[model samples]
Target: MTTSSGSSSHVTDARGPLHTGPGDQHIYYGDIRASASSDRSGRDPRQVAVEELRALRRRFVDPVGSDRARELLEDKRAVMLTAGRGHGARTAAKVFLCQLPQGSRRFRELVDQAEEGDSAGRALDREQVERGAALLLDLSTVSSRRYETFMAELPWFLKVVRECDAWLAVVLPALWRAGFEHVFRGLVVRLERPDPAAVLQAHLRDVGIHVRRAEVAVPELEHELTTATMAQTADLSEDIRAARENAPPGSGFAAWLKTALAARAPGAQDVEAHLSGLDSGAQRALLLTTALLHGARTDTVHEAAARLARAAELPEVATPLLHHRTLTARLAEIKAAAHRGRVRFTVAGYDAGVRRWFWDNYPQLRGPLADWLRTAPGFTALERADRLELVTRFAHERLRTGPPDGLAALAERWSGPSASPEELTMAARALGEGVVHARYGSHFRQQLYRWAQDTALPGHRAHVVIGVCSEVLSRRFPDQAMIRLRHVSRHREQGVRVTAREALARITDSDDRLYRSLLKRLAPGEEPRGLRDLGIFLHVADPARMAGDATVGALLADHWTAALAHLPPRRWEQPLRAWLERAHTRPVARRPALRALATACARQRAAFGAVYAAACSWAAGDPARRRTVNALWEAAGSVPRPQPSRTAAAAR
Candidate 1:
């Protein structure tokens, strides 16, 4: 149960061309079906989110204004929550959205205009506000100008929300509350900071720590609680949990609390003190290695430390390995220890502290550190989990201290042409960390977008990007994931293209809105890429994959009309045959499929002639096949044709 980052942009309604190239015809329907089935067998993202939300709910303490906020959300379907920083406003917003009965509706965080690309100036796209959706629009980080733009569009956005019967919870910046109070008089709910001790207690209890209230109400703890943010309190509980786990047998809660509190003390001074005691570059490199791979086997950590030292060009002593200090002595010097073959810091949170100290104090070493991480995880003695954990730790520290470019560059390097399996996994893990980072996710998403569009992207890099887009980004940012997948589906590499298409098909098959959205984006037009677009369209548009609802019927009709008018019969004939086969086998899909085809034909007589010719061709031989085609054709012709209005005619 992990938290996702904020400040993502909304997906635009602009329909883009999906052009798979000349060999797209090779992407058979069977390939798509196999890919979709495989994808379904994997973990579902929605379930993961729900479980995370449930975990958060276990630790949530209602703030002072939460009751009123809930009332506003329930009665009016939208609420603007205002609280100063560190009041857990974002957490509260998620909790509020989670309170809504999920049903089939999605719980999504909307990207604001500030983050949205070309559509930044427009109101929220009405199409994205699906009915019964529980939405969160976080404006806490937007500029005043962007906030004002959003305010100007609030009326239209609210109109769409109401029309769709959706719920929205907006977390507003407290600084601008006074400025916009008049505009949103009834819609705003000003929240007071909740009791920090209560938050701590809830978190502790959530981790199975139960104690009397009086036991935790001591003055030393009280002072810290008074000053600590809700997030800090939660961290305190986590530290306490860790401390308890590491404490000697028979250690009590009081002992654990004391240790946890000390760990929370200003860590920079402690880290600086420990570094001052280390006498050599080798020792310092070992400390950094242990910090990054905190719990790896002592031997693995030693090898990684040696690798880091060499990569950073740290001069080693001329003394022989046996003549130099032992690994045990070095570990003691760094205030770390090895127990049961694994190494970790003596202090509960000291590893993270050491990581921060190095990342902050010596910015020059950042490049060397990144380089070391690229290859250090490939130690033969390191297990898969150890390698991935090392990459994860490095990604966290790098993203925390610098711009995302460094991490993004490392991902590319690791996934380059000569990358090993371990290097590729490192690349995937690093990019995944960036995707889920609270501050830098949007930056990483942009990187993914660029990589998806790179024609010369190596197959390995393409593979990593596709995996992250499908497994990582798709969970929290499905729309962005879909956009990237669509781009990758057009890659020059055939296997990459097929994998991308499979991800697209799997995603759309499970969500009808996305299916329609994909259709609109791939809709045929005057674009010269009609052949490829039609191929992709036919691949995902299996009649057996869609529900027999009127909405799906209408979307199919509209797209079929454009595809029929623009594409040659040969480009779509196989898919048409597939759909006809489904209509013949599945009673429920028969009428809707035929009627959609008929509607397309009625809208374009040339399309009707094409369909007639294809059907006649298919009916040429077998008696059973002829009977099915004749019955489908007769039924399709009987369906009513929509009349073109005079206004439509004049506009055309």
Candidate 2:
């Protein structure tokens, strides 16, 4: 063997046996295979694999690397093929191939070595084919058993092979022969499906060479283990069923009621007799169901109570029915009073304390209240808004002190026209308290959005509707609030716009931080892009007030056109057209407000052009009116537009 330093080959004892020690300098597969057991004895398995790896590295890499050693060994192929002229050379090639990286390097070397023979006069024989098969088995055992070492060295091995393209065209026909197919198939399974050498997998299928997949016995073994243990489980289940069938008869209330009621006893006369035999818990369950069933009337309740008293020989039969006898009686009384269309109770008297008392014991009172509220003629006749306000106030007050019981149902019924500001306020209050019910959330958000856009509502009240939306609904319903804030930012009223801008500021807090950083870098006279998109420009508080500060006034004036045009014409008309129509007739004291409106309207001349045209039409044939229309147009022109930045240009 040639040494890495280009020294002559070492003299051997005609080789007695190869030693795996550092002083050893010969390769012997037979000696190494036998020494494996002794080398591994009383040693860590990982340490043994490491020691064996170092020996193989010394034999392979030290001999001018595996590629050169493989070429030198293949040079003796003609002699090795003839009788035993180069047996040692063939053995060296097999050992060297086993030490190389699995598929890419080893398989390519085998095919390349065979192809060289075709170019020359040599042809592959059974000896070379057997050597290749044995080398694959040995390598597979190392990879399948000592996986840690193979994986640790794989990255460097692949890096070496990938730097060359010569291996791409080679194919190993020896692997497709009988008895050698499994080695190729096993490598294909172990590699990724898109591996560079995946053509080998197609070749195997084309040649009809099938390697049976390994049987996966893990799930089957688990089933057998479970089946063995489940025999006792099956027997236990049957025994439980038999016990349920053969058990003694029950003397519980349901059993006794079944027997007593089966007789029918001419109109359930013995229901009280049956009740007397049950425990107190059973008695409460029975009477509560009976009183709430809608079939039981006032007389039926009294008769049932009287019969229980006679049968039990007590002064009275006590249950929640007897405890809240007044509320129960009031339930029956409400029907008659509700029919007459008047149930006298002052609204002031129904305070939080009264609401709390009813809800504190809601379980006992909900059924009767629900029955009266649903069935009472007066409840049905009450104005929709009034009824909604009543129940909503009750629900809000009750939820203020406890979890949402049945009050959400009452609040949900107040949809459509009944969803007033007061109703929305109550719903907002419930939401802020973390009372998350599906009914009060999205439906109420839709109602709040409609109310905010309702032009018929006075400006102050409409402002209040949105104030509740921003203050309470922003956290849970942020997207809805953002849409509303975008539309309302240009409201005709300065106070309402200021409120909306403040709400927009609260909702976009994180984005505003980023905008603030970019705002600092803006040139003194240049407008920032996406100013309206970031919603920062919406903070135009009382344009008259902002006009006093030159910096803020300049900022608004610069982006005024872009901001106003961001929303379309249809949106501005709802809140703005009415104000603009009277812009010409307003007193001189209101000129600043009118001028501010003109700044926004003048931005989108195409959309608001009609409004300006209508003003000019109304101004026709009157010099004074025409002069006012001309002044409005002049005011619109006077509002500033951003100049091209001289400072930015100079710096650039």
Candidate 3:
């Protein structure tokens, strides 16, 4: 059953301060302060991944075949983990990679091979497989066609992994094992589910809950352990932790256990029973509104409930206000409580249960609910936190149910030309939730790709798409993020293109590989777009950011060669002079910067002449600057220029 103790409780609300945990950092649009952390200065995604790995390590219990998998991985540098769904194969793969010795190597989950029929062959570029890198290729969700394509390329991929001395753990789909079993006989490790009791115990202890074996040996707990998957067991442990924290100060473990158990399996039944007694349309509207905005202020909930009633075409009662039951009494009848000013269900996680029951049992109401949510954020006095919470709740339900297009349609509507700034923010946040979802992330990526390539996309919608790319997708999927941003950078709207360019520059500058990737993508263009690319190149090519690394120096030289070949001296003179000025001032950057510039000019006489002219003008007055220029010119002259190409000679 769906419960609030699932990932939903990790969502921050207006009732409390936001906790900046590892899980919290990836949420792009929850709190304003949290949102600020998603900018250029945000925590590195690699570091965040490592922190999550560490957190996983704390709660992870080794499934059966883990040792064999590790042995195979160490011996072959690649191991295929095969297990049925809910057996923790993905987690086991990650844990295997995490157990490797820490070093300068990269650790990341590689995106799947592109879908069938695409000429790209495999999405895993050769440049991505660096030496000593630890990679995970989770193909559990691939379609049959994609899986066949992956199998065709698996041999070459493994060969590359071996050549690079890297480690790889592939989580294969269980259904396809027989088809490829003979081919990868020795490489496959069939993993079995770990003991549910042990999994639950580890999760509980990881969260600082101490319980004895005897304390957890109840009949109900035993039945759950026997029947539940590893994921559900972990969810039960989380529910217990949430229940304990929300329990009264002096409540014992028994009380928390009872509350958690009731919330875990029977929460939907509880909601169904509660809703059956409520006959009035207004009462039902208020109940559903409270579920969506559980921690909102009571006044906010009241106003939103009325709005929802109107949207659903629920008839207004003719009873006088004095004769009607008060809001507090109605709330009591619906099993919700108003504490101080905030509203929530009296039973923990019951709000989530209520939401699930309504969405699952009444399919027709989904349209009215979507329409109501479109204006609920605006008409109600929702704080930023409340608005974020509303969007997240709505997104979670939509993604969990069928037809994911409802959330997409609502987000697009909110991002229309006439939508307000608040509506736009809500739209972005709603899509952000989808981008970070475990199951529907690929769907949202495809959706954003379509939006990015649309010629008629509105400026406001472009802004929302760019915000999701920079803020949400960039954290875990930098490659996809860069691709989308580059597409948006070519948009007709100047402001949208500029914002996309800035985001691209910031994201690439933070990592060497990404920087090189962007340079390669932008270095081959011609004319007007070439000019824009040059501007982005200059913005990210600061020597201070490079830290004078030799590899960065080489990349800088290559980019300069492209720039020199395409643009006139006037187009690049200022940034070239700025580099020379920095060389004159900073001793550490002098050698690498000068060498890169000289190397860029080594092959063309005209390029050499442009650098020589720029340097002479830049150092006209200062003696030291003059000496640096002289040295740069000498280096350029030492490298002999190549003979002109046949095309160039014929043109001349």
TM-score for all models, in order of appearance = 0.79, 0.29, 0.82
Each candidate's lDDT (Cα)?
A: 0.72, 0.34, 0.72
RMSD of 1: 7.0
Sort the predicted structures by lDDT, highest score first: 1, 3, 2
lDDT of 2 by residue, 18-118 (tens): 11111222122122212212122433222232244333333321212334434533432210111112112222333444443331112212211111223
Looking at model 1, the pairs that clash are none
Task: Show where candidate 2 strays beyond 4 Å.
Answer: 1-358, 361-393, 413-560, 563-582, 587-615, 633-640, 643-652
Number of residue pairs clashing in candidate 1, backbone atoms closer than 3 angstroms, sequence gap of 3 or more or interchain: 0
lDDT per residue as tens, model 3, 360-421: 98888999999898886576568866777788888888998755788888888988888776
For model 3, which pairs clash?
Answer: none
Who is ahead in TM-score, 2 or 3?
Answer: 3
lDDT preference between candidates 2 and 3, better one: 3
